[model samples]
Target: MHPAAQQAISTLLAEGKTPSVATVKAKLTEPLPMPVIIAALASYKNNPEAITHTAQQSQPAPAKPQSQLDRIEAKLDKLLALLEEKQ
Candidate 1:
């Protein structure tokens, strides 16, 4: 199972062993339905590249599309100007 592979990877990492993708693939003796074992091993292998909660950024969000809002504002401005001209 994935848990077993995870344990193996964790142990290997703890023992300062840098296992390759093939090495991790060889560790899974039992037949599994998916590649969760591979994924778990990749997580260990690429931990530095993997995103984590500690790596979260604290910055403002990027700008989003505001065309609808701009159009509505233009319409409102036109209405206001029309009302002023009528009065």
Candidate 2:
């Protein structure tokens, strides 16, 4: 099961709502394919602990690297300089 779907299932279980295609879809931040959701539901049914396990195993989104941000800032600075030169 996709981590997102697993997380959604865990959340739904915690919320005391049954996890179904529509219900899970509603709980998710982004829409997932029906097949993936269905598979997740099957996985959950086969092993209820998987949801809890997945939730615990899930990692938070990593922050964007500072170097990448700096590169973008440098590009924007160059663009501004070019625009000023034209003016």
The top-ranked prediction according to TM-score is 2
lDDT of 2 by residue, 1-87 (tens): 787788778879989998988888877745688999999899999999877876777755766534546878999999999999999
* Reference-based lDDT, residue 65, model 2: 39
lDDT of 1 at 13: 56
Q: Write the per-residue lDDT of candidate 1 for residues 7-79, one digit (tens) a residue.
A: 4454455567665555555554443444676666567557733322222342225555345568689999999
How displaced is residue 49 in candidate 1, in Å? Answer: 11
Model 2 weakest 10-residue run by lDDT: 59-68
* 74 Cα displacement, candidate 1 (Å): 78
Clashes in each model (backbone N, CA, C under 3 Å)?
Answer: 0, 0
Clashes in predicted model 1? 0
Q: Candidate 2, after superposition: displacement of residue 2 in Å?
A: 0.8
For candidate 2, the C-alpha RMSD (Å) to the true structure equals 7.6
Task: Give the range where candidate 1 is weakest over 10 consecutive residues by summed lDDT.
Answer: 51-60
Residue-pair clash count for candidate 2: 0
- Name model 1 segments beyond 4 Å from true: 46-87
All candidates' lDDT scores?
0.55, 0.81
